[model samples]
Target: MSTDTEALARSATKFAVPESLWNDDVAADLSPPELLLYRSNLLGSDLTVTNFGGGNTSAKLEGVDPLTGETVDVLWVKGSGGDIGSMKIEGFATLYQSRLLELEKHYSGPDDDDKMVGYLPHCTYNLNTRAASIDTPLHSLLPFAHIDHVHPDAIIALAASSEGEAATQEIWNGKIGWLPWKRPGFTLGVMIRDYVKQNPDVQGVMLAGHGIICWADTAKDCYEHTIQLIADAASYLNEKLGDAPAFGGEIVAPNPERRAIAAALMPKLRALMTGDRPKLAHYSDDAETLEFVGSADFERLARLGTSCPDHFLRTKIAPLTLDPERLNDQAYLQSSLEDYRAGYAGYYQRCAGPNDPAMRDANPVVVLVPGVGRITFAANKATARIAGEFYGNAINVMRGAEAIGAYVALDEQEAFNIEYWALEEAKLQRMPKPKPLVGKIAVVTGGAGGIGAATAARLMREGACVMLLDRDEAALDAAAAGFQSEFGKDVIRTAICDVTDEAAVAAAFKSCAVEFGGCDIFVANAGIASSAPFEETTSAMWKKNFDVLAEGYFLTARSAFTLMKQQGEGSMVFIGSKNGVAAANGAAAYASAKAAANHLARCLALEGAAHGIRVNTVNPDAVIKGSRIWDGDWRKERASAHGIDTGKELEEHYRLRSMLKRDVLPADVAEAVYFFASDMSAKSTGNMLNVDAGNAQAFTR
Candidate 1:
């Protein structure tokens, strides 16, 4: 019969790899230079090739240094903090290949990582600047101009199985070498160099429970070969397992209220994780997640282990799963998570050495929600999204392995060593210290405009995840996008919520729970303004004004109260007005509503104090810019009332009239709101803080 190589030689295969994209003829087509970074980008862009920070690539080239005016043989390898898909020239740290190769003699064992980490930087072409990757020596020792390494889902499926070596040999035969699972460092690099030297005919090496490495003379050939290698494994799985198990029957449309259920559980989960102290941003909702979570063996399978051991840096050894049907059962979810944390502690105790770093918090980075998919928690928005992307890709890898064989991962002791390794832990030192409000979640009602939007942006700057709620869809989308662009994607979310409606207010808070584990600071800032003398003010006019300003604040505050009480502590802020304090004629309805809202805030503060909650109001006047409350007619009347023309004069008038001689910007109001939300004003509450540029008339008693 045909050999494995002969079968792969045939064009007919289920797994497909992209055609090589290298373009050598520059004059024929004008484009960015197709060099190492270009090729790296090609590999990095496809999640099929690697997950976040999962792969490394290198190119050896003869180059002239503009700085030194000398000919140099440089190995440009991917540096930390650079994603392959978006790799740039700077992303590729150029190291003297000859200098790197000499390190093979220096490495005594994996324990040498700490010393190697210090040593590798010294040998870099630019010693004062860029540091080379730990795998630099392995890349330099290989006898190839271009090298590609990846943790592709399909490839990992085969790499992380009991029959990985046998299955791989069946497919590639003598064309590939196999390496046992050796922890990544100097020793593993030496083993790879020796193996490749012995079997020069092999195109690649499959490292069991690790990943795959492919090397060649050209970038295109190396990249294509790596893709082809992964594809071969995928094709093998397809032939044996007939692809992943399909979901049974039409998945009846998911419970439309799963999000609501998740909301109720967020505080419960947070209390279980942090004891009702800090808030964390959470993201749950991806279609493919349910298939994995709902599988017959999920409860047992998820606990078995991770398909990729290195993922322990983020996801720990395994994920904690909960019954999807119990999404709303707060008591059950909380108890389950408590058990998960206890189990993790026990595992740490079993594997931890005397020198290991202190155990990390028992809280999980990824929570598997059966019907809902996954809920990823991070200190901030960007990290949560990146982690979600990584774990989301993991589902596919494990599914692929399961389709072929029982998935295998590193043992507890091994994973613990990698996770707590001083070298690995040192890699995280480069990240800056977190801001004061890091891990706190803030929800702002009417956040699509004015003071609300300003507060959202400010909270993000201080390292809090924000959820913006508004009645206007367009404004909500635009505002949410702006904050997301500035802060980072998935950090800020938007929900259309009309605060005057009790049900809408309830659902809006629930969305906040799903977006983030729960709320730390809830801002009731929805408001509107109108002007009319009491003689002309109809009952309808008073009702409309009260419905939004007074009633809306009550509804929003009431909703936040319930959730905060569940979590045991939270902050509530009301955006009031100077109009409420200094009563103005011809705007009696607006003034009365504002006055009533301020009173409502004080009452909540009184009640909130008993529950460990703090309530405050930021009362600002003429913070008119970006305010939805100020319509054209209202602005015109305000200017006419003050005998000023144009919007600029109106601003200047308010500025000069204030004791501080400056108009109150929306940001000024936000600052006061932030003070109450943060511990800065930890002891002060049940009162209003004036942000009207020092308006003595509006000062509280």
Candidate 2:
């Protein structure tokens, strides 16, 4: 061989070793300039595997935010969408480690972005653009000091092949882990989290049909390993297929008409995922305009996955194809839908075995048809993007596979196995975001008092942007203040609303949607209580308590329910009293009102189920904080009237009667309220959870 040819052969052989096996120490001490060089070389190989803005990179450092009291902090996560190969300090967002961890613990409602809160606690981003990369949670999920997420085409090409996973595994040699596709964002991050927990030593993860993730002790190590990882995969591919083939087929052109088609389907698709119309990002007018105005294959092109995995979690496995041939008639569309449903059922039955689990629903994430474009589905804008990514990638892989050896996806049975796998499905149900209610708008009736305040605070913590509705504006403001002090002003809202008035209730519901997008969770927590003999409860006396507790709960819950039903999915909680089940002597009016409210909750649950909404009731025993009936003098007078010691009367009224023998505090009721309002109880509907410290059994006059 010529001397230069001999040198080239040696260099190529040196690059053949698996990169992940390298010790951290080798790249650990590299200077910044050296680190940049390593990053460039690594990315050159991986970049072909990633699409525009498909990945992010970060390096960890211990520091303090000088402007924020010099608190010890985990500063600077790279900005969303910035290329890691040439990332700069400015690309990173500064996050307070303590705050991010704290936010993760905050409970969120089913309707909110728990992931965003989790990300927020760890990263700070540009307030100017108001967008963060969807992969931020992956950064939070990693324990390593550095993190990198990329859609390496070679890695994905290897992973997307019919035997892609097996092929990658041969190269990965158990050092890396694999996550089945899900649309990106919280769901994908969660999938990564579970995998990492099981395989703490995994240096990288392959997102099938999506991308790759690589991390280590430092930036240079992470970047270099990524290079090595991709090179190894490429080598494997080269050995199997010889030289890679050139792009042979006609690329699909973009058509502007595709946007109108996508826009039409988005509304229907969003409701199916979330049971509500979640706030979504605008569709890409640029891409749609280009696609719509350009190509005949635009529909086929839009049917694929995004450049990443979690996009499937958000968008589903594929888009529903809008075939022009089929679209010509309603019957044709109906027939196609029937086939889809049957296919889904068949797929489900084939997958579910004696040991297999069940999911909330078995539905196709996407549908494909010839001629027309695809419609991506999601619960929100973020989810839609994720769904789109998954579909986009799937189309790419399927087409490519056809050229090699006919595109074939995991069979119905195998797909079913994955779709219903316990761990995978559980990602949808894991340690929920504390603020599941964050992006969602909500209203809490009786939000001025203890139960109301506690429930509202709990919802805020979980992520609902709230409108505190009550007649007592000052008290509502005070209650909201306590929550705002802890959570921040953006979370709590207050409005002077008397639940007794239909017009006022209607207005409040309207206000909630207008202020914070739309209402998704409602807490009918406001009420009044008083005791009077059934016969002596005059019309005026009867009307007053009943108006607020019974009629009020009904009115607010009804309006919220109507709005929620229209939105497609929602959750509502009615705060009932233990008196509803075990009546108190001389408390006929209060008990009757609570009983009615409980009934209403059951009815709401049954009706809302069709819309994918959930409704439940929380019944707590008497709480003493700021109760109108429990003023000191009144308590003493009541005890004397009842011929019982005040302490005995109070004790006998609550704690000692229950199995747990503890007072049911406002916070305790709030816990149950939060449970019913969030996804924790996605399958628990129309049920009542008692927060009486086991007081349901003990009752007396």
Candidate 3:
């Protein structure tokens, strides 16, 4: 592999799909459905074989019908909207083979093919609720016992080439048949079934502008054959490719400062793209992405769009490419966005029928910036990341097709038809409704602490992506790892940031912008505590308290406010203490510093109001359990102030001191923080909410 970007583009290496990973020992004890799942995972694991959620696999098995005590053939296929790689047995839809064959009798012809889908439910086997994919007939109508339908980039390249049919015959020596382009449906499935009957020796058939389908008499053979077919296609393409440069050779080198540039550009792009709803962003500047975007043929190829239905469904018809030389030109960027929207709307108007689903948001999902990289936006982090992966697959397809012959995209009419298909529309409608904070991004200072971690978790549960910032690197890693396991890696990121350092605070916010587009909620919860009489307070104690609570709040808020102003709307929550308002008897240094922090929120709220940014404070008192602050000297100091033991006695003292006589936990403060961070407090700003168990002196004036 070459290290130079241009040299890497010019170097053509052999593309070898991994060999079949099946083991006889593993398959010996497995049931028919379990074997099918094992086979599906092996194929779907490699992107060269199939992109995420882009393929279907099935096995025909004998089972006793639940309603009737008779043996019947059941078609267990990958269900709708399921990813073959990670899916379990439950992800497969079970339908009676005889009933699926009977569905063909009611099918009038090609025009009435869609009506066939409506009858699929009547064929349910074992009363399985999993919805059958539209590709069900492609498996059931075939004569083979097992089938694999996958959109491998290698095979799709030949399928999408202008000379695809002739190349398919030359490469496979007539063993793999070819068919012209047709939208996937019952009609296409019937065509495939008839073609295989005519060519009895064929191993598989490549569908033009789509993918390949191969089958065998048993599960293992079918899985191996699928891998072999892809490997062969890749082998042929590599020989034909020679040392030819991909994508017409790189036009420019990858920029070293691209990440910084992307960070600067994302917030603006996010603001532009979020007309309907907010979108989280994923950025990729990998070797492949940088090579394609910097190539001379980038614009021409990107404009032609992705050929596979699975590709376009996730990435949209075409990506919006920005001029590398004018990337910093704001007017040019805005104009380009407007032009792309206009083109999309025009395409919709030209191809849509009366019954088609109303046009979706016209914003582009994938954005290609030359010399920088690819940035994809979606309703959440996972979808955004997957969109980028799918586009990368499309790039590979384009490279292979162009190497063999001229690359071709799906026709605009056909693309639009599939894009607005009624079944696809129904699938969209079936998706769960968006959560309250679906596309929102949050940053929490002191994120390794109890209250900070609790606040981050609460925000994530409501659908927000979060960046955890703490000065303690080990603690930050542990906290981030826990959240990543629970919420997924894409939604959580960590930064070793001391909020008191102005430069680190700014850089952390910049990283948040680059990682998740921008911040919408900023939780300034980082703090320190000190307890001393007014006369006994040391200079270092007062300054240290002021530095973290007062100065740290000021720095993080300033950075967050800048980002929110760019985003046009945001929320900021400051975690203060009840002592800030009530004034503690022995904790003069901590109490006075908190008072300054509370006043800072009011000032920021006034400043941010006109820009649609809301600032509020959550004042918590005596939250000892699970609190890192209370784990150290602060606990002993507060205990001494109250003349109580430094253990359970201190907790009981605080509980009884409150009017309600209840213990305050980190979760309680977190809820109050969430209220201010969410739209529930949308109209309320410049206000302080006390989370203490009701102290008379702590009552707001």
Candidate 4:
């Protein structure tokens, strides 16, 4: 900011500073190096400024070598594999400028460029090693004390165009160096050095098909200059393009409708993307996505390449664009995705060196459907969401380039080198192995609380995309929120479903299918408990228990069977009751209903065996503490009917009946459910697992 408060207020720069930060005396007290970290965070927090760890920042500081005991001017540059947006003091890897320049001689030009990235850790300011940004040399060669290099969308629009040179001079009112596209290495670093030598008065340099670099002695000056450069480019583009059209032609359906479409298409899409195997699908149709898909040049612009190289690694170079008319054509959709996969393999082959690892999976990260917007696929919800965010900003960047001039992207070879770079590939190898159920989809009925909620959480912990269904709208919502809070968003989908209603059951399954493709594991857990002697049972009371406990299981299992039959594989677990086996007195309605449900599971198992679907049952006894079925006076009712005095005594009666004599918590039932839901019981079906602390009565032969 200028020293004059009046001029600062009236500055009219398109890149305006937050008014609250303008006169902060505290910021003034921060050292120049500390301000570099501060300003990098501020610039990075905005996706338009830097997309997904795509930028670097630096500051020059004097440091005494601990071992050599000599005062050396060190260039503290943002390290490799760190995000500038959330970087801290340690994020800047300190390098001795004198030692760094020594490696510039062995360059032998671009062929040996890989050495530039490999040699950085050995050129540190002290004994501790850190992988510095390959661009560290450029920062040390520049005379400025503070420097920032970012892939801002506005500037990249100009930098990536054929007209980058003329536009840079026209917009900034100062000549900017323009180097032809060169992969980050010794050659590019040297080119930057020679540009400074020639253009002694220039404030910055722009790399064609790459991005821009700016510097000044102060953090405020450098950051302000970076912002102004971006602002000016944006102004030039806006003036040339006039007003941009708001993204349109989207359906903007209600949640259920959108979810239904998602469920219907997701299965076909997942099958196409991964063949017979399973994967996670994340759907969206936000305004930016709507506009991008609806645009006339959507296909041409999308094929141009990632908005930047970093985006390519996360989003792939180009998304798979599918026509909504082909939604029902499973063969065609799968064929289209397969063709995209093959094309990516061909691209990798054209640029691969012998040292490069086999081309990574052929699946495209982003898939676009007109009117439906976009869907990102990943092993888990978290990575899919990350790619979704990157691709979202990418549409804006590509559009800006169209408005500015022609949007040019890195060539296939340029992007291939970065994608296959050993350093880059190593990052993925370092990630921990995924959970066993990482890509599996699970649906848990009655998921609001009790055993259902515990099973939902456990499935998510093992990395499944879980859908929660219940009759209580408020409880279902609260349960969904808790899962999302614990697992991060998009991992859980909730539906207000009364399992007794076939239409609602079908819709809930349809929504789950759309949200996460289709179900791999189904838990028919929704039930109601109403007990009375067979002779005393009223028609109303008998009908209610049977309707919820038996009919609900039948409806859910049918949906699960249909989905599995179509896909040729699935798992189902019916939550049964011990009363069904022991036939407790005065529990005729509850026991009989549960008995029918258990038998229903066995019948379904016989038919599903042909389609590779496994079905089992979990008989849980006297889960009295957390059972909502015993919420009101039902606990007392059950106790009195059984000749027991209190709820505590009633629970103890069932506990003592078990061989292990332990309290059977809801989580205990969830564990038995997980065994069948996962591959652990791959060959087991038509079986009943007693989760009542070893109740012999409920045990199956």
Instruction: Estimate the overall C-alpha local distance difference test score of candidate 2.
Output: 0.60
Clashing pairs in 1: none
Per-residue accuracy of model 1 over 80-123 as CA lDDT, tens digit each:
65678877677777788777877767777767766776767756
User: What TM-score, to 2 decimals, does candidate 3 have?
Assistant: 0.98
lDDT of 2 at 275: 28
Residue range 14-38, candidate 2, lDDT tens digits? 1122344334566588764345434
lDDT string for model 4 (1-701, tens) is 22322221221112212211223465678876677788887778876677767789998888899987889888889987888888888888998877777877767877776767777777788764556887787787667788888887677767776676778888767756677777676777788889888888888898776788888877777777777777777777666555334222122222224445666777767755654357777788775676577556777778777846767788888999987667787788878888998899889889998989887878988988765767888877667777888787677667566665677788888788888888677777988888888888899999986999999988888988899999999988888888888997778998899988999999988978767778889999997877666798899988888898899988888887877776668899999988877677787888999999999999999999998999999999878777777775667768778788665788889789789999999989999999999999999999988877886666676
lDDT (Cα, tens digit) per residue for candidate 3, span 1-701: 32666476766434655577889999999988899999999888888889999899999999998878899999999999999998998999999999999888898898887898899899999889999999999999997899999998889889999888888999899999998998888999999999999989999999998999999989999999999998889888888878877878877788888999999898888877737568999999977788788888889999999999999999999999987788778788888889989999999999998888898989999999988999999999999999999998888888889887899999999999999999998888888998899999999999999999999999999999999999999999999989988999999998989988999998999899999999899999998888887899999999999999999999999999998998889999999999999979889999999999999999999999999999999999999998999999999888888888999899999999999999999999999999999989989999999999999998988
Best by lDDT: 3
- Root-mean-square deviation of Cα positions for candidate 3 versus the true structure, in angstroms: 1.6
RMSD of each: 5.5, 18.1, 1.6, 6.3
For candidate 3, which ten residues in a row score worst on lDDT? 9-18
Per-candidate clashes, comma-separated: 0, 62, 0, 4
Displacement of the residue 47 alpha carbon in candidate 4, Å? 2.0
Candidate 4: what lDDT? 0.78
Which residue pairs of candidate 4 clash? 247-291, 262-514, 263-513, 263-514
Worst 10 residues of 4 by lDDT: 11-20
